[model samples]
Target: MKMLAAVVVLFLAAGLSDSVILTKCGLKQQLQTSLTLPPNTTNVLAQIVCHVQLTSNFNTSAIKTINETEKPHESQGPRRGRSAKNVRPTKVTPKPHLESGEDKNEFWTLYGLFQLSDHVVCNSTQRHSLNLCGLTCNKLLDNDISDDLACVQVLINKMTAVIPDPETAKHIHKMISLIYQPECANAKASVYFADCPQP
Candidate 1:
């Protein structure tokens, strides 16, 4: 009985060892240092902090599986011969089965503190990934978040480019304002980290 108890304790310790629950202040400091924003960008850092807090709650080992089904294109109509009653759903092969032993069809997975997607941003054992970040998905789950921040910068740059107005494109805070409710705008970035210990 004692031997079994020792094994259980060790197993729990090993699982906990890989994950780091970061303090809000720690996360803020890391973001300030790691992310490269444009000159005079305001509240963008806080917006990121709010986003991360909502997404993963500062847990380094956070992961979420999204079951995404392929949507039919707007231009494509229903099949010519198949009626609604005759149509059947086809099962697609699961992509990128993780080494961690989850056998379900994980269409897309959000990983780590920032919840970066394995489908386009990071590579995994799963096939048919765009791998825009050119790094492994496992890297995002570790305590070191510099790589994750670098990828975020890439995504931000891409997003800003899509905006027609040059002034709005210069800052991501404007983008956040458009997406989130007015009450939850960049002004509330500090609110997300209010619980953190102050210096």
Candidate 2:
């Protein structure tokens, strides 16, 4: 009986330590700097920030669900609480911590995804385009657009909708091509140390 109790305790400890907890969540501000992004772009970039955060949330939730399911029910006695009748589980994943530096993947990595420093020229030319892209992307994402190509379309279609003044429209039109080019299309999303791109 003592041996069995020790084994059970060890199992509980392991599960407790293994929970899918996140350590920190904000890396958005760092990338928002003008050196990497324009000041006015914050609103549009906010959309991107929301996008990555949603992805992280989904990850945490899915992990929680899966972890909960995989764990065997807690041991129960006839007198245990009502929950004891079901398979009560100890948390298997650690909760996420919100501090940035502590967990690169849980915080800093996702922060990088919102960093749009790579193409300043393309970005500048596409400010309206990008902002419009962000709006449309949020809309489509609300409706569901997981792949890269679909997101690119969101930008293009939104740009087409409200034709801006000639000069700005001309710039937006230029951005349309730039966005779909392989490099931009293949832009990476930094997901807490993992690549959150579609296969």
Candidate 3:
């Protein structure tokens, strides 16, 4: 009974602490390569469930979309002739493709970035009590900026092959820079972003 109470208290405390502000879906879309998942919810729930998901909308779609987006493998057939040319079938070669590996789980990576930035803002002990938030943004000038750059590189390499749009791509890139840039005293990164409604 005591343990259960402890866990519940921890849950609410964490939730309130990690309160969300802005969620950059466009930025995630950029890093995630605009691999659209099934449209399934309202803006309210988006923060709670955003990075919380394990599977990616991309990988799920890949099984279906790959054929259309990717080039078909060359068909192999048995060579016909006599002894020397003895009819062995050639193996088909699949086209080389980009793999997101874990990056496909856009939310997980973003959440991780947020968690790291949170360290810079709140004391290490306070890190435990954080809520499920959407923004999961970073607001450090130098350090978070470095992380954002790394994330951008990951997404550019992973998602570009899928999205293939320059303008949307640029928009996402810009947002990533915005996410990591520092704000005032920095009580929490999300608070600053969530304060004003997203334009």
Candidate of highest lDDT: 1
What is candidate 1's CA lDDT for residue 145? 79
- Give the lowest summed-lDDT range of ten residues in model 1: 69-78
Quality of model 3 by C-alpha lDDT: 0.29
Model 1, CA-based lDDT: 0.61
Q: What is the TM-score of each candidate against the true structure?
A: 0.60, 0.21, 0.17
How well is each residue in 64-168 modelled by candidate 2, as lDDT tens digits?
Answer: 211111111111113233321122223334345445466444211110122111121112232223253333222322212222233343443545478757655
Indicate the worst ten consecutive residues by lDDT in candidate 2. Answer: 107-116
**lDDT score, candidate 1, position 101:** 50
Which runs in model 2 stand beyond 4 Å of their true positions?
1-25, 33-35, 58-199
Q: Note the Cα lDDT for every prediction shown.
A: 0.61, 0.32, 0.29
Across 1-199, the per-residue lDDT of candidate 3 in tens digits comes to 9999999999997765533232344334333343333344223123311221211121111111112211111122322332211222232333343355833421111223222222112222323312112123333112223343353344334333454666545434433332332211122324322433454
TM-score winner among the candidates?
Answer: 1
lDDT of 2 at 88: 26
What is the Cα-based TM-score of model 2? 0.21
